[model samples]
Target: MPAARLPVYDAGPPCVSRAVDAFVRMGMAGVTFGAFMGSYDAVKEGYKGTGRALFVAKSAARNSLGWGMFGGAYMGLNCGLEALRRKRDWVNASAAGAITGAMVASTRSRSGIRVFGTAALFSSIATASEYLRPVQYPPTGL
Candidate 1:
């Protein structure tokens, strides 16, 4: 069956575009009333005034599921590719962190930025580590 013979495709490592796009979308979502209210509450508590804004920023980022997933996947794929190339994991982590920082800095709410940032960082680290140590599988004759 054709289905049985379907070939696995390896798309190249994801780039910053995907991560950036995801961050943009997430930032836009922060404009909603819910996000506004949440941001307001956070700011009112002096969370925004102090260096603790990042703590609240993470809370807001969780509202945008689509953006979060895209950013997460981008980091994951980037890490995976880097690992495959046997590069240091920090390289991928730094890239992901930068993307998250951009997303956070550009967005209105610190919560959104923080959450997405965390996702990006973790995804990048995890995927890169996984990719770096790959198990060899025997080839199957098709």
Candidate 2:
């Protein structure tokens, strides 16, 4: 008797599609963060009505741009590093994210502490996410 063969499946979506999806997700996250921070800042500064709304909108836009750029750079760096090292690791991703976070913080304030703090926060989050990622195991024949 011949042995049974497992079925092969087609790979889902192209690389570009995956990249676009990731970019959109990161952009949305940035917008949300910006909206919250902007609203808080506006309130702290005593903004009212139209002023608050306008501030929030502007902040959201700026954040979207910053996050989109960060996402692109992070992905690019991760891919490039992986290609060179032939392995995927969180160091590249975290470093890219940290750099972008510092840049964003610098735009918001001139304090060195704030810039480094933001970079550290972002890198820590990235590392945590990487650590908590789901592991996939190959199927075992029973």
Candidate 3:
């Protein structure tokens, strides 16, 4: 009698898909924030014109692009590190996220304190999320 062979699954596509999903979600959030901020500022200034709407649109678009790039870099780093380590744990993900946050902050600000502060903040959030996430066990064949 011949032995049965199970199908082999590849993990690469799933990682890439997750990265793309992160990019889209982050980009949308940035767009929403930018739009809200731009409208609020416009309203506070008592501006009522097509120009104001245009400004809001531009702001949203710019924010979307910026956030997309940031998310791509962050996800890329996280996934790359996970692939290298062959482990999917919260600590590794948080470290990668923190490093990316610090790098982004350093580019925008000249203050080392600000960079490290942002990094610490991101790390804390990531760590907290890890703790809050529910754990699930694989199904056992009955």
Q: Write the per-residue lDDT of candidate 2 for residues 80-128, one digit (tens) a residue.
A: 5544554446775577668767877887999999999998998778667
12-115 per-residue lDDT for model 1 (tens digits): 22445545654565556643433666567776776745544554455555555545654555555555555465454556655655565455444545676566
- In model 3, the worst 10-residue window by lDDT is 133-142
TM-score of every candidate relative to the true structure: 0.28, 0.59, 0.78
Best of the candidates, TM-score:
3
**Which order, best to worst by TM-score?**
3, 2, 1
lDDT of every model, 2 decimals: 0.52, 0.70, 0.74
Candidate with the greatest lDDT versus the true structure: 3
Worst 10-residue lDDT window for candidate 2 reads 133-142
lDDT of 3 by residue, 33-85 (tens): 88998898778878789978987898898888889877777777767776667
| Pick by lDDT: 2 or 3, better one | 3
lDDT of 3 at 61: 89
Ranking by lDDT: 3, 2, 1
lDDT-superior candidate, 1 or 3? 3
